[model samples]
Target: MANQAAPVRSFLQAAAKTEEAPLPLRVVQIEGLAILKIIKHCKECSPDPVTGQLLGLDVGSVLEVTNCFPFPTRDEDEELEAEGANYQLEMMRCLREVNVDNNTVGWYQSTFLWSYQTEDLIETFMNYQENIRRCVCIIYDPSKSNQGVLALKALKLSDSFMELYRNNNFTGEKLREKNFTWVDIFEEIPIKVSNSPLISCVMTQLETDSPVNQCDYDRLQLSSTPYLERNLEFLVGCMDALSKEQQELQFHYRILARQQAQQQAWLQKRRAENMARKAAGEEPLPEEDPSNPIFKQNPEPSRLNSFLITNQIANHCNQINGAVGQNFSRLYLTKALHEN
Candidate 1:
C-alpha cells in the first residue's frame, strides 16, 4: 500500500507543479448570517481578540463565505487543546449532517483597529497554507465598526511573499530581487455581504417599522476625542516598535560590514603569501577554501521581523489618517452648534 501511494503522491505533485495558479482573489462574498455572527462575536468580546473558522466554497475569483463559527479560547493546556480539536471536528460533522457547507475556506479574526499584520498572523496563515492551497484571513475591527461602517476586510498573503516565507529566506537580496516589501506582505481583497432572500425581506420589514429619523442622535454625537486619542496612542506605540526594528537591522548591518572587511583583509593576505610560495618554487595554496571557517560566507539575518513591524506601522498610520479627518469635522460641528 505504501509503495503504491508513493507513486500517486509523486504524480499529484508533478501535476500541481505544472498547473497554473488561479487569478488573485477579486472579491469575498460573505453571507449575511456569517457577517452578523462575526459582528456579534467581535462586539461581545470587545477589546479582546477572538477568531473563528470561515466555511465556504472557493470558486473562480470569488470566495463565498456561507457560514462561520468561533474558535474555543483555551490557554496552554494540552488537555484543553485536545478538547478544542475535538470540538472543531464535532462542529464540522454536525454541520455536514445538516447538509451545510462544511468545507474550510479559511478563518476570521477580530482586530483592534486593523492591527492584524503581525508575525503571529503570518505564522497562522502559513499554517493554513500547509493544508490548504489558497485561503484568506478575514479581519473585522470592532472599534472601527462602531462608527457607522463595517470594518471588515479579507486578506490573503501574496504568492511571492509566501514563496519566500516557505523557503524561510527574507534576506535583503532576495526581497530586492523579488521586489517584495511590507506592503506586498498581504493583499486586501474587497468584501461584499451577500444577503439571502429571506434576510432581504426581513431587512425591508425592519426598515419600514424603524423610526424615520433613525440614528441622527448618534450621528451628531461628539464622542470622537477619546477614539482619536486611542488611535493616536496605538500609532505612537507602532512607531516605537518600528524604531526598535530599525535598530536591529542597523545592528545587523554593522556586523555585516565588519565581517566583509575581515574577509577582504584575509583574501589580500592569502594572495601575498601565495606570491611568496611561487617565488620559493613551492606549491601555492588555493586562494579560497570552502572548508575554511574564515572564508565561509556569513548567512544573512532574516528581515521578516522588520517587514512585519513596518506593515503594522503602516496599518496604524492609515487608521489614524482616516480617523483624524472625521474627528476634526465632528469637533468643528460641535463648536458651531454650541455658538448658536
Candidate 2:
C-alpha cells in the first residue's frame, strides 16, 4: 500500500527512538516554537498547501510537538513525491546529529479554508500508523487565520473509524452496523501551546508595553462579507460533489433493481416452461442457473467518498456559523457603545 506518504517509512524507522504511545491519544501539547514555525511556513506558502514532519515525544496521552520543518516543494510532481521521502530522512539524520528532537511524532500540513477532510489525508494517516502507534496531523489553515483566529488543530482518525477504514468497507450496511458517521471520521484532539517559563516571562514583559495590540483591530473589523462569500463558495462546491456521489449511488441501485427484475422474469419463464413440459410428459430444465448473469451479486458502491464530502460540507457550515456568530457579537457591542 504505497500511498502519498509511502516515502516516510525510512524516516519514521530512523526516528523511532521512544516508546510507542498507548491508544486513544488525548491531547497534543505543541511547543510555542513549533507553532511559530508552522505558522511561518504556512504563511510563507500562502495559497499553496505545504506539508512537514512533526518531531517530539508522545508521552502517555499527551503528544508534545517540539519542532518541525517544511517539505521541499518541486515543480515536477513526481520528482517531489519520489524525493520527498529522502529529504525527510536526510533532515532527520541532520537533526539527530545536532541533538535535536528528531523523533517522528507525526506530521503537519496547511489547508485551504479549513477544508482538510479528504481521502488523501486518511491515506497519509494510515501510512504514519504503519510506523508509529499513534500520531496526529496538525492542520493549520492560513485562509481561516485571516479572520483573526489561530486556525491550528490536532486531528487523528478515530479508532473505530480507522478499524472500519482498514477493512476498506464503507458500505452503508457496515457503517450502520458500526454506528459510524461522517462526523466520526476524524477525532480532533485539543491543542495546548506550551511555552517555557523563560519564554512566558518574556512574553509577559513584551505584553506590558501595550494595553491592546494593533493586531486586535483585525478581529474587530466588521468586513466579513468576503469571508462569508468564500465560505458559501466552498459550501456550494461540496454540495455539488455530494450530489454527484448521490447520483453514483442511485445508478448502482438502478442497475441492481434491473438485475433483480431480470432474475425474477427468468424464474417465471422457467417455471412456465417446466409446467408446459410436465403437461407434455417431457423432462423439465432446471430452474436455477448459476451461470446466469442476473444471479451475480451487484456490490454496492463505496460510501467513503460520499461520507468525506459530507464531512467537508459540515466544515464549511461550521465556519460560516462561526463567522456569523462573531458578526452578531460585534454588532451588539457596537450598538451598546453607541447607546452609552
Candidate 3:
C-alpha cells in the first residue's frame, strides 16, 4: 500500500497538469441497483456498522460507482483480517476477468444515528485516500431509511485535515493555525442515483405489474412512538458524551498550563543559582533550559471525537423536531374533525 501511493500521487499530479483548472470533484453517480444492494446489506447488518468496497472509475471530476460488495462481519482476528484482504483481492480479480470496473474507488459503511465519525473511520479513510486520491466513504443510515426515506452520504477527507493527519500533528497551535473545525474534516460530495434505459424499462414493467398499495400511505401517516422515543434517548446520550468530552478537554488544558508554569519556575531558579555561583567567583554551572529535547511536547488531545458527538446530537435533534411537527399536525387535524 505504501509503494502504491507514489504512483497514485504521480497520476493525480499528471492529470492535474493536463486540465485547464483543477477540476473539483462534484458528482458521485451510483447505479440504482448498487444503491439497492447497499440498502439491503445495511438492513441485514442492522444495529452494527457494516462495510464494503466500492468499484468504479473517475472521469474528470465525476465518480461513477458501478458496483460494490459487502465485507463479511468478523471479529478483530489476524486470520480474519488476512481472509478479508484475500477476499477483496479475489473479488476484484473476478470483476476484472468479467471486464467490469475492478478499480477500488472507495468504500461504504452503514452508520447509526450519524455515528460514523471516529478515529477508526478516519484511519480507514486515510488509507483509502493514500491508495486512491479521490477515495470517498459512502455512509448509509439504515435507521433513517426505515423511516420511509433513504439516507446516503458521500464524504471525503478534506485536504487540509489530510495533511495535518499525515504528519500526525494535532497540536493546539497547529490546529489554530489551520483554523480547523469539525465540519472541515470531511467534505460531503453530492450524490445522484443513475439507471440505464434497460434497467428503467424493467423497473417500469415491475411497477405496472405490482402497483404500490394506497394503504401503505395510511400506514406511513401513523405515528411511530418507539422511533421517536429511541431518537430522544440517543440524543440525550450524545449530549452527555459531548459534555463529558468538553470537561476532559478543559482539564487537559489546566494540566498543560500548570506544567508550563512549573517549567518556567524551575528555569528561573536555575538561572538564579548560576548568578550566585558567578558572584562567589566560582565556575558557573552549565546553563540548563527546562524547555529542552528531554522535555518532549505533549501531543494535543484529539477533539475529533467531541466534534463527531456534537454532530450526532444535532442530527438527533433534527429528527426529533420533525417527528414532533408531524405529531402536532395530526393532533390539529383530529381536533378540527371533532369540531366539524
Candidate 4:
C-alpha cells in the first residue's frame, strides 16, 4: 500500500494561495438621514470550512444633515411624528454600523464637528486588497431622506478625491450641462472611496452566474461618392478613353479634307497651261495623254466651275425661272473669266 502524502498544512495555509470563498451578503437597513458606510474586511475563517466570510468593510462614510423641518403640530400629529421618528432611527442605525477609520472625523450640522483620526483603515484595506479575493462596502439610502441630505462631499476620503481628480482631468467643464441621473449620483458623489476596487469586485460577482452585456467602443467609417474605389476608377478611365477617341477622329477628318482640296488645285493648273498652248494653234491634247504635248488639254467646263455663278443665279434668274417653270436651263460664267 502506498504511503499517503503528509497531511497538507492547516486548511488556512492551503487556502492562503487559493481564492477565498465568497462571503454571505448581509444588509443593515437604515432610516432618517442618509449614511455613507465604508468597510474594510480582514482575512478570517468561515463558519464552515468550505465557506468564507467578509470582514472590515467601509460601505460609505459621509453623512448628510439638513435644517429643522416642519412637522404637523395640530391635526396630523400621530402619523407624521411616527414616520419622522422611525426615519431618524434607521439613519442612526446605518451610521453606527458604518466602519470608518478608528480616527475618522465626523462632521456635524455644517462644519467640522468631531474627529476620530483613523489611520488603520487604509492599512487594513491595503492588506485585504493584496490577499482577499473579495472586498466590499455597503451603503443605505432611503428613497426619501431629506432629499439626499447625507450626500457625499468631495473631501471624504483620499481615494474618493483621487477618483474625482482622474475624472475631471481631461473633461471640459464649460460644455457640460447639468445632468442629474443615477450615473451622476454614483460617479460624482464620493459614494465609495475609489470606484476601481468596487468595480473590480462587481465584475467578479458577475462572472459567477450572471450574463454580462459587455460595452465596447466600435469605429465606423464613411466616404463620399468620389472616393469609392471601383466606381471612381471606372468613371475616370471611361472619360479618358472617350476624349482620346474624339481627338483622333477630328484629326482624321481634317487631314482628308485638306488632301482633297490640294488634288483639285493641281488639276486646275494643268488645264490652264494646256489652254494657253492650244490658243496658239497647237492641237488640243487628249484628256489622259499628257505626252501628246502640243494640243490644248482643256475639257468641257465642270459643274463646279460655275460655283460662283450658281450663287448669283438665284438673284439674276429667279424671275425667269419662276415664269419658265422647268425650261430655264442656262449656263452663266464668272464675269472676269468671260472678259479674259
Candidate 5:
C-alpha cells in the first residue's frame, strides 16, 4: 500500500523537479530514465507464415519501456543487492495501492508462482513464474519479415517469487507465516495464465499462423538455428556502438526499394497536377516556370541524388557498406544480389 496514488504522484512530482533531461552525451540516472532491452533474434522473424518480404522484426526492436522491471533472473543479482529490499517492498506497495487485499494477495502465488513480502524486501521477491501465470494479455508486432525473432515461453520455474528471493536464506515456514511467500503480499488479481480459462483463450488465438503461433509450432517442428550460426553476435556488438546517423542509414538501406517506389509516386503526382489543369481548360503548368527555372522541368532524380537525399534526410544515413550497399547502392544492387 506504500506507493499509493497520492504518495506516488507526490514522489513523481518531487522526482521530476530535481531530474534533468540528459544531453546528447551524458550518463542517465535510474530514478528518471527507463530502459527496455529486448532479446529477439531467430529465423522465424517474418510477418508472413510462408513467404513475404524478408522484413521480420529483428532481435533489436525494443517493445515497450514500462516502469516495471523485466522479470529478474540470476544475472541481475548484483542489481537486486544494490537496490536493496526496497525493491520488493515497492512492488508490493504498488499492488496494494490498487486495493488488492492481503487474502487475495496470498492466492497470487498459487496463480502466479512468486513470493511477495512488504517488510523483508531484499530476500522477498515476486516469482516471475507467478506473474506469467497471471498475465492477461500478450502482444507482438506483425510487420517484421523473418530476418530474426525472439521466442516467448511459458514459465517453468518450480519455486514461487518469494522463495527464490534468497536474501538471507530463512526457512520456508518462517517465510509463509511472515507473509514473505508469493501469497502474503497481494491478491491474485483475478488473472491466471495457467488457469483453464486462459488456456482456451490462448488456444483460440494460437490456432492461426500468427507469429506467436508459429513460434510455438516452430519450436516443436523445426530444429532451431542458434544465434551462433548467424552473424548476430557481431550485429549486436555493432548495434551497441551505432550512432544515430548510422542507425538511420541502416533503416534507409532496408527500405531502399520502397523509397524508389515512393519517388515514382511523387513524379506521378506532379505530372497529374499538370494534366489536371490542362483538362480543366486552364493553362497547363510548365514543368518548370520560366521565372523559376529551378522548379521548371526538374530532371528525375538519379540513384546518386537519392543517396545524397537520404543522407540529408536522416542523420544516421552515412554511407553504408556490405549488404546494405548491395541493396541501396547507386549501381545495380538487385542484379548483384541475383548474381551472388
Candidate 6:
C-alpha cells in the first residue's frame, strides 16, 4: 500500500505545482469506445438519470477516460447499499486483475434538457473530490444527441469552493470573502474523443460495407418545430421555477431583516432601563447577551436550486435560438428557389 501511495502522492504534488503555474488543465481525452458505451447506457436509461463510474489515468493535465460501467438505480435500503458497494469493489478488483485502468478518476451521469446542475450532483462531486484530489463529473445529454449532436461535458468543483464546502461554511460573509458564485462552483473541462489508428481502419471497413449512407445531407429533412417547441416549453418551466425560488429567497431576507430590527429595539430598551436603575442608586440589571436562546439564528437557504434552474433556462434558450435560426435559413432558401 505504501508503494502505491508514494506514486500517487508524487503525482498530486506535480499536479498542484502545475495548478500554481499560469497554465490550466483544460483537455480531457475519452476513448471513442467509452463514449459510445456511455451514449448507449444513457439511451437505455432514457428520461431517468443514469450514473456510471469512470476508470482512467491522469497524464499530466489531460484526463484519459478509457472505460466505464453503469450503476444500477439506488434504493433507500441499507442492504442494497451494502450490496452495491461490494459489487463495485469486486468489479474494480476484476479490472485490476485484467490489467485495465482500474483507478476511479470520476463518474458520469445522464441529464435531460441540461438539468444536470443540482444539489445532489454537487454533493456527489464533493464526496469524490474528498477521496480523489482531482475528480470530475461527466454529464451526457441524450436529448441533445437526439437532435443530431452529441453533448458530453466534464465538470469539477473549483478549488476555492471545494475548501468552503469541506469546512461546511456557506455563510454570506464567507461566500463574499471567497468571491464564490454559482458559476464558479463547477468548472467545465473541454473533452476530446480519440480513436486509435486500428479502430479508425475498422470503422472505415464497416462504413464501406454499409448499403445506405447515413450522411446524405441533400435529402435531409428541415422540420424542427417539435424540437423547438420542446425547448421553449422547458425554458418556460425553468423560468417559472427560478422566479419562485427568487421570491422565496427575497422573503427569507425580509424576515431576517425584520428579526434583526426587533432585536436591536429590545437591546436599546434594556440599556435605557439599566441607565434608570443606575441613576436611582441601585445595581443595574445584569446585561443580557443577544446570543441568548431568544435570538435564534436563521439558517441561510441554499441558492443551488435557483442557480441550476437559471443555467437550465439559459441552455434551453440557446437551443431554441439555434433551432429557429435553422428554420429561418430553410425558409429563405425555399423562397429564393420559388422566385428564381
- In model 1, the clashing pairs are none
How far residue 239's Cα lies from its native spot in candidate 6, in Å, is 2.6
Show how many residue pairs clash in every candidate, following the order shown.
Answer: 0, 0, 0, 32, 36, 0
The local lDDT score (0 to 100) that residue 307 gets in candidate 1 is 81
Question: Model 6 over residues 153-238: C-alpha lDDT tens digits?
Answer: 99888888778768877666777787777677778899999899999999988777656555344224477777777788878888
Question: Candidate 5, after superposition: displacement of residue 199 in Å?
Answer: 8.0
Positional deviation of residue 3's Cα in model 2 after best superposition, in angstroms: 50
- Position 177, candidate 3: lDDT: 90
- Candidate 2 stretches greater than 4 Å from native: 1-23, 276-284
Model 4's lDDT to the true fold?
A: 0.32
**Per-prediction TM-score to the true structure, in the order listed:** 0.87, 0.89, 0.83, 0.18, 0.19, 0.83
Q: Rank by lDDT, highest first.
A: 2, 1, 3, 6, 4, 5
- The candidate scoring highest on TM-score is 2
- For residue 56, give model 1's deviation from the true position in Å: 1.6
Model 3 worst lDDT run, 10 consecutive residues: 210-219
Off by over 4 Å in 3: 1-22, 75-78, 209-219, 286-296, 333-340
- lDDT (Cα atoms) of all candidates against the true structure: 0.84, 0.90, 0.82, 0.32, 0.32, 0.80
* Model 1 regions more than 4 Å off: 1-23, 79-81, 208-217, 289-293, 336-340
Cα RMSD of predicted structure 4: 44.4
For model 2, state the Cα shift of residue 49 in Å. Answer: 0.6
lDDT of 6 at 246: 83
Model 6 ranges off by over 4 Å: 1-24, 73-78, 209-220, 291-294, 337-340
Question: Can you give the lDDT of residue 8 in candidate 6?
Answer: 52
Q: Is candidate 2 or candidate 3 better by lDDT?
A: 2
Superior candidate under lDDT, 1 versus 3: 1
- TM-score quality measure for candidate 5: 0.19
